[model samples]
Target: MSQSIIAKRYADALFQLGKERSKLDQFETELLTLREVYRDNNKIVSFLKHPRVSVDQKKKVMTDSFQSFSEEIVNTLKLLVERHREDIIADMIQHYIGMMNDAKGIADADVYSVRELSEAEKQRLSETFAPKVGKQSLNLTNIVDSSILGGIRLRVGNRIFDGSVSGKLRRIERELVSTNKR
Candidate 1:
């Protein structure tokens, strides 16, 4: 099976277990932390993937590193190590988080602006855009992007609502070119 398919299956199983234990929120939090650690530390993954490392050593390392994490997450990491599927850890965590977010009616969004958005602006954007995306609310991450020039560009999932000045200019340019072609 494909890596994504395997990851999704693991995520689904973890999600079901989380629901059964009434620990979905906690598991989500732990998964997020694991994602962050994996992102920031390449050495950890490298160490786990090293051919010289024994499965027992890898499992011990994972358990020791994440002793504070819940048993479910720790066991999952150990299982991944044992199976030599460390590469899918990040994808699995992401899928699990996505499942949790869907259950909570929340969507993660990136709002790109020329400057850092104020809390009020973020709240207003969340309010205006959440319903349009069929989500109760958005967990907005503001990205200061000078390339947008002005206005804001909001991205939720694969959809991008581009209201930036540069985006508008590009749209107009496209229209003009298409009109000229005709």
Candidate 2:
């Protein structure tokens, strides 16, 4: 009933279907693309989740939206709509991708920097972070965020190491206040 459970169920079903049909990679890609579409476009999401709209209408929109995508993904979206499982759309796709990566023995990495990191810097960071991950191989993604002020925030799976200037400032402020109180 919960979104998490629905996502897990849909992800498992999709993973099994993908594995059996030997199209897991394609399916994963399509799913990820569709998930991004949903994330970036608020209108499409509102249409699907709108209580007034019929499932058939939503399915049509989904099919039209993903016209260029693979039949597997389009059909899967249709099935999800038909089953009233739209809530799990994003989570299922993400979870399915994770499963596919695991199957290929690859790990996902995310590095957030205050500014665009140079290729050499990225490579060095990857080299430093990748080896620490228990995953066989790592796929590192760089994200630039000016709000960090300075430094990098490396996230490998669920673990996050915050090395940003904001984080440092907060730690320093905390220590300062604590010392002042003492």
Candidate 3:
């Protein structure tokens, strides 16, 4: 099976468990913490994938490091270790977080502007664009991009709403060139 399929299965199972136990948000937080740790530490990956390491040793390491996480998460980590699928932990967390966000009618968005956006600007953008995208709200990640020149560019999924000054200028230039050619 593809790694993504395997990751999705695990994510779906965890999502169901979280939903049934009324701990979806808590599980999301735990998964995020684990994902962040794994991303920041290459040594952990090497340790998990080491040929000389016993499964018990791997499980013990995970348990020791993530003792603060819920039993469900810890158990999942142990299972991954046993199955030698620890590499997919980050993918599983991303899928689980996506499921949680979908359940809550939220979409993750990337907003690029020349400068950091204030809370009010974020709120305004969320309010204006969320309904258009059929989401209740947007979880925006602000990116400072000087290339936009002015205004903002919003991306949700595969769609982009480019209202930046550079974008407008490009559109006008395209129109002018096409008209002249005709």
Residue-level lDDT for 166 in candidate 2: 87
lDDT of 1 at 160: 98
TM-score of each: 0.90, 0.74, 0.95
lDDT per residue, candidate 3, 1-182, as tens digits?
99999999999999999889998989999999888998899999999999999999999999999999999999999999999998888889999989988988999999999999999999999999999999999999999999999999999999999999999999999999999999
User: In every candidate, how many clashes are there?
Assistant: 0, 0, 0
**lDDT tens digits, residue span 1-182, model 1:** 99999999999999999999999989999999999999999999899889999999999999999999999999999998889899999999989988988998999999999999999999999999999999999999999999989999999999999999999999999999999999
TM-score of 1: 0.90
- The segments of candidate 2 whose C-alpha lies over 4 angstroms from its true place after superposition are 112-115, 141-153, 160-182
RMSD of 2: 3.7
State each model's C-alpha RMSD to the native: 1.8, 3.7, 1.2
Order the candidates by TM-score, highest first: 3, 1, 2
Write candidate 2's Cα lDDT for 73-164 as tens digits. 88888998888878788888888988888887777888899777787887788667766775666677889898889999999879988999
Quote the positional error of residue 7 for candidate 2 in Å.
0.8
Where does candidate 3 stray beyond 4 Å? none
- TM-score, candidate number 2: 0.74
